[model samples]
Each structure stands twice: as structure tokens, then as C-alpha cells.
Target: MSGSTAGPEALEPLVRAVLAALADGAARRGGPVPAGPPDALAEHVAGEYAAARGEGALSRLTSLLAYGSADPADPLCAAHLHCPPLAVAVAADLAVSALNPSQDSWDQAPAATTLETLLLGEMAELVGYDERAAGVLTSGGTESNLMGLMLARDRVVGRASGRQVELAGVPRRGPRLRVFTSAAAHFSVQRAAALLGLGEDAVVPVAVDRDLRMDPDALAEALDRCADDGGLPVAVVATAGTTDTGVIDPLRACAELAAEHGAWLHVDAAYGGGALLSDRLAPLLDGLALADSVSLDWHKLGWQPVAAGVFLVRRAETYASLARRAVYLNPPDDEEAGYPSLLGLSLRTTRRADAFSIAVTLRTLGREGLGRLVDACHDLARAGAEAVRSHPRLELCSEPELTAFLFRYLPARGPYDPVRTDRINAALRRGLLREGRAVVGRTELPGTGPGRVRLKLTLLNPHATPADVERLLHAVAEAGRAEEAAEEAAGRHTGETGEETP
Candidate 1:
């Protein structure tokens, strides 16, 4: 074949080979993932990879971080926040990559930009925002939070007299722009403050209630103190769903306090924003539209692939603070034509059309279908919590608030030893992952004496039933018992207790 035609035809065979391999693997495994890892196949692939990398030229490129090695779709895979993408979303992602559309401007993206805008409008409506609401697509919750804080900072410091701060080079000086959030809130909020020239100390850590929700009274008191001291309280960051416990802060109360204090209210609803789809938990997000800015992650609960997040603002003009003009790119003539460019609204220059997958998923699963998925996961979490509480070996740390539960395995007939308990629980978790039996999560919570290390379960897989979670709990308990028995046997033979080894 000619060189021109051969290059294009060469990829055809490789694509066919990959599809054939995938079909055969799926058939042999009977599903996406088997009960355990394919040790032999993994070893063979590693050997081939090593040979292909060879000496100096490509050795550094072989990082051993190969794809398809971890079974994220397995019922027992519950360690991290990662999840397998839906088939529809995955297929749409492939097309997105093939198209390689840059959604930073209307001319560049066209249909993709419109799709993203429509989706953001839909999401804003779900949060009860009015026609004045607008948003921009982001990488994930972290970027969304960062963008939201940037807007808040701009609103507080920029445009005091209908003039642009950047064009005038206005020197911002005052109380240093402090923000407040609960202790249980995600770390990204503090990080955003740091990046924005507000030191970490500028992020005041507010107290939480017994259920881990932020206390509105405490927040109001904090604001009052700041006001008395002449400190600028710029924004109040509230967690709609905490990363650890999935507890949502009292949004309505927080909004009211923020308004009274003359501060911007930003809600980090990355995890629980999908609950807006659920009729039962939709009320938990009441007054969310009252927030000046909101952050959401479509990858977490929206069930789209990775890098689907959004940051919405109640007022569309808030983005003008970050606006810029470039002669070669977005010229003055183009601005007058009503062309929309995302460059003024984002921290990125070249951005992928991540919202394509989200648009496809939402179109495939309408509002009702998405809501049902969210409700189903919540119900499964409740069932799993009940099973854990009923079991003699496990103790529930708190009730199920969202699709997450915190608990620890308790040994029968003994006073809880903090060091030994931590070691035992850690070993059980490691064993679960190594043996592929389950991927039970671990966390540290305040205990009676010292803080105790505990386990957590964040159920995001809609296909995961209550029985699957029960099996996982039982397996963890059995592993814990075995570790305890081993510790007892070692203690009996030796004069030392298990504390020394740990």
C-alpha cells in the first residue's frame, strides 16, 4: 500500500484486535470482573511490558501504571471514590476524544458549548436558581471550589465603583479577606484561600454539631467577633456533603447568617448535589439557590466519567471580574458580536469538552431516572447500616445520613485497646484488598479515650445491593476475629502484649 493510505489503514487492524481481545476477555470472565485478580494474565502482561520497554531509550517511560489492571467494577472494590463509568458515558467520552473539541469559546465548540450551557442551566434549576443564574464547566470539585472562591474574592474586592480592578491595578488592602467553614469541610476550601493570597490562617475553622453539621449560632458568633475586630468576612463556605460522613451543613441557616453578615455564601455540594435528583433529600438543599456560588461534581454522584464538575453563580455578571481581552484571540470586534468565550470565566486556557459525557448521560437518563438512581443508593446505604448495627462484632459510629456509613469492628470480651485496635483494623483492610475479598474503607474518628481508627463505606455503585454490603461486612468481621486470635496466641506464648509489636 502507498505510504499515505497505509498509515490510516494500519490503525484499523489494531482497533479490531483490541475489540476482539476485549470480547474474549469478557466472555471468559463471565462479566467485567471475576471474584479475584487474574494473576497469571497480569504476570504475563508485566513481562511483555518489561520486554517492550527494553534498555535506556524507553525504560523511563515504563512506570508500571498500566490501565485495566484494577477491577473498579468489582462488587468488592469499595476502597476509593473511583467508580466505573456508565456504558453510555464511556462511549460518549470516546467520541469526545475523537472530536477533540475545545469548549473554551463558542466558535471553537459550537454545539458542545451549547450542550454544556443547557446542562448547566438544568443543574441551576435543580438547585432552585432563577433566570439570572449562570455557570461554567470545570475539571472536578476541586477546580469548581477554586473557581467559586475566585468569584467570591472578586465580588468582595473588585468593582467597588463600577470600575475594573485589573485595568486600574487597584491595590487591595484591608482585613485580608477571611472565610469560614466547618472542621469537617473538604480541604480544598482552605487550599483555595491559600492560593488566593489569603493565608491558611485566613480560613476560620467553625465548629460542628453532634451530627457533624455546621452550627449556625457558632458561625454567627464568629462573624460578629470578626466584625467587632474590623476583619473582612468575605465568604462563608458550607459543606452540602462532607467527604468523611456525607453530612450536609444546615444550608438555609448558613445562608441567613452569611446574608446578615454581608458576606458571600458558597456551598460545596460536590458529593450531595446529586441528591437534588432525589425527592426525599431535595429539601436538604433548601436555600442553596440563595448562595452566591455553588460547586458540584458530576463524576461523584452524577455517574458521569471523571472530570465532570461545575461552578454556578447566582448573578451572571460576577464573572466579569476575571474577564480579559487579547488582541490576537478574542478581539474587540468579536466582543461586540455577542460571541461567548469561557476564557474570562475559567483558570484554564485549553480545556477539553468534559461536559459532553455529562450531557449524554443526562439525555439518556432523564430527571426521573437520575433521581431514582440517587434514591436507590441512599436506600442501599441505609440497609447496609442496619446490617452493620445488628451484627455483634461491628459498632455503628453514626446513623446513615447519605450513601455513607462509619463503623468499626469490635472484638468480643475485652476492653478496647487503641493501639491494638488500630493495628487489627488496618491489617483487616489490607488483607481484604490483597485477597480481593472486599475493599472496606478506613477512617479516624474521635473515641472515648483517644481517637479510634474506624472503617467507612461509601456506596456509589447502583448495582451494589444490600446483600453485597452485608457480605463485605461479614468478611471484615471474620478478618478482624482472625487477627485478634493471632494476637491472643502470640500473647499467650510470649510474655509481652500485642502493644509492643504494633
Candidate 2:
């Protein structure tokens, strides 16, 4: 393992150059994102990664994504909640990367292990849990949720004739275990079921009300039917804030249902966890305390870098399934010596110090500071929804529950045609993306009809105001008109020229 010819000393200049290039590109991104034509976009990306082993190529490579990618930091980039992170988070990330510490064990990462544990405790408190609550840093909502369901599966199987699933496989003699969740719930739950050997079919899609909240009565009836059919109830997954609509399920009612059915309760609050900071928004998480486990992703709402996810459980003892001991790792004598450890907490053996950034962000923003950001985004969503409803061309899809909107543009043309409308809306979104004018998102609106396209605006930029959102909608409308005009021109060309309008 000989050192490179450049040596470590050469990195200082390279790093500085990289940062300067990134900063320059970021500063220049003051306008809408560029949605370029096919050839241009392809060239930009090709030039970015084209040449290899060339001097100063890294600088050009940095500029490729730095300038070409849609800027989530820009208030106009209303696409997703993986928004611009706090500067402190970036700095902390740099420190962690430099230190290269792993929080898996006390000897491996003493400070990181301590910091992660304390931060997990603070996060548990935010979830309205007592001192008994235990948590571990995860990759994101998906891993957090996978472990939660894994725990539920083990417990359910254990209760089923005292089977230990870790040693013995999932019981084959009993009725298959079923997980209940709203249709609007995150897909991670189903994915978790598959990983845990429950099969995707193990999940039961409970209907949601008009507000997209899980219907408690429907869940109750489903649970009753499951019992009658001799189906073993495993867990009830409740969504605190769904990804697409940001809808919150009725947590209290879901908790009650879980209690009555003797099932584990897990709340997927990866997107909505930031509401716990705001007194106003926190109420939406009522009955969260009743959940057996909860997932939170600071990267989504806490203004932190990626991979800042936490999984909290009400009882610390429930994590016994993750416990493992080895002489080289957690030796028997070392455990008795009171050396604090976090090795048995997560699914990873060499976990990064993600909690370092999370701790710094929480301390930097405090609860109120974080809450204000959440409040600002929610206000912007309401304002944007109002703007949509008032606009002649735009129609609000559903009343916003969080900082998100699901709406589509209404063309000023002949009779309403779902197919034509969906096409125009989708084309308009792609046009906007290609031009980099606006980074608006698009999703199917099954509520309206199958294959229907609906424009989405996830207002993650806290500094953005209602006026900014109005301007965004105006931009979207203009793009829609241009897309419609292009479509009409193409149709007319096809009628006259009779050649395929490329």
C-alpha cells in the first residue's frame, strides 16, 4: 500500500480549487434551473465525465453538477424536501469525513459513539418518549422502517407459540402475518415486509379518507376480518407525513387499533418529523407516543446533509435481537467494565459519524429555529395552494396538509380531455426540467383517473414566501401554455405535412 505519487500534501490545493469552483457555480445559479434540449444536456453531461486522468479535470467535473443540476437551495426549486442543508451541517460533515470515525464501537469512535447516543436520547424526547426509549442512527426512513418491521416480525413470531425467528425460521404452521397501513403510506413498509420474509402480500392496504388520512374504522374492520380468518396481525404502520401529499394519518385512532389487535405500531415520520419542533405542527403527531417505534430523517426537514436518519423504539429492551458479542468487539470483560458502546444498535458494522452533523444542526438551530423553518414552509404551501385555486389555468388537486401541493394546469381549449390534459401537463413538466426554468415535480393522480398527470410543488425552501410561490405557479402556467402551443403546432404540421413530427 504505497502512497500515491501526488502525496497527501497535494490535496490542499486541489481541495481549495474544487471549493472555489463549486462556490462560483453555486453563486451563478441565481435564476431558474436549466432544462436543456436532448443534445445539449447530453453534451453537458458528456463533457463532465468525458476525459480521464487529466489535470484540473476535477474542477470541470464539479462544475458539471454544480451548475447543471437543479439547485434545491434556490427558492424556485420547489421539487423535493431534500433541500439545502444548513452550513453548520456541511461543516460538521467535513469534520466527520476528515476524522473518518465509525460510531459502531467505543474503541472505534469514542466521541462519535457518545455524541450519537446523546443525540438519540434527545431525538427520543422529541418523539414524546420517556427515558426508556432507545434509538439508533439509520440510513434513512427505509432502513429505519425495515428494522422496525423486523422487530415486529420477531415479536409476532415469538408470541406465536414462543418461536424465536432469529434461530428458527418464520413459523409455517400459523396463518401468515399481515401488516396494515393506508394506501397512501410509504412503499418502504411493503419493501420491509419482503426483506423480513413476510412477502409483499403480507401488507394490507387500508383505505384512506378524502383527506388521505388512514380510516380507523376501515382498519378496525380489516383487523376483525384478519382475526376471523386466523391471520396473525404483525404491525400497523402509520404515516405521520406521506411523501407525495404530506398527509398525516390519524395516529391516535391507529394506536388504539394496534392496542386492541395486539400488534406492534410503527410510525413513518421521516418527512414529518420536523413538525415535532413546532408546537403548532407537532399536534399533528398526537398519539405518536403510543407507537412502538418511529422513524425520523433529519435530512428531509432538519436542514441536515443526507443520511441523518433515526429510528426510535419505546422500550430499549426490544432491541435485544440486534445484540451480538465477540471477544475482539464487545468482549465480556469489556462490557462489565462499563465501556459505553453502540455496536449493537443498527444493521451496520462500520457506520459513519452521521450523528455528528445531526447533533451540530440541532444545536445550531435549536427547537424554535427549526420550528420557524417548518412554519415558514407550511405557510408557503398554503399560499401556493391558494394561488393555484385562484388562478384560471391552475386547479388545486387537494387541500394541502403540509408544505406540498398536487395540482395541474387547465388548458384554455376545447372540451376537457383527460388524456390530452395529462399529456400536456407531463410535457410541460419535462420542458421545465429540460429548460431548467423550474424544477417542478409530476405524479399520477389516480384520484382523478388512471394515467392522469398532476404537477407537484414541495415547498422545502423556508425563506421562500407566498409571493415567490405565486411567481412559481406563474412560471408553470407559462410553460404549460408553451407546451400546449408546441403540441398544437405539431398536430397541425402532421395534418398538413403528413410526416412524423419529430
Quick one: best lDDT, which candidate?
2
Alpha-carbon lDDT, every model: 0.76, 0.84
TM-score of each: 0.87, 0.93
Give a tens-digit lDDT track for model 1, residues 1-502: 2124464475455445555555554444442233344575577556756666434213222222222334456556665556667889987886677667787666777788778778888888988898888888888788888888777777775633344444553245655567999988889998988887776788998888887789888999999999999887878999998877789999999999988977889999999898898888888888798999999888887788888888899988887777776665577687689776666767787788888898888889987888888888789889989999899999888676878878888766367666666778887877665554676778776335433777888878888888988888898999898878887877732212434542
Alpha-carbon error at 25 in model 2, in Å?
A: 2.8
User: How many angstroms is residue 94 displaced in model 1 relative to the true structure, after the best TM-score fit?
Assistant: 0.6
Number of the predicted model whose TM-score against the real structure is largest: 2
lDDT of 2: 0.84
* lDDT for residue 145 in candidate 1, whole number 0-100: 84
Between which residue pairs do clashes occur in model 1? none
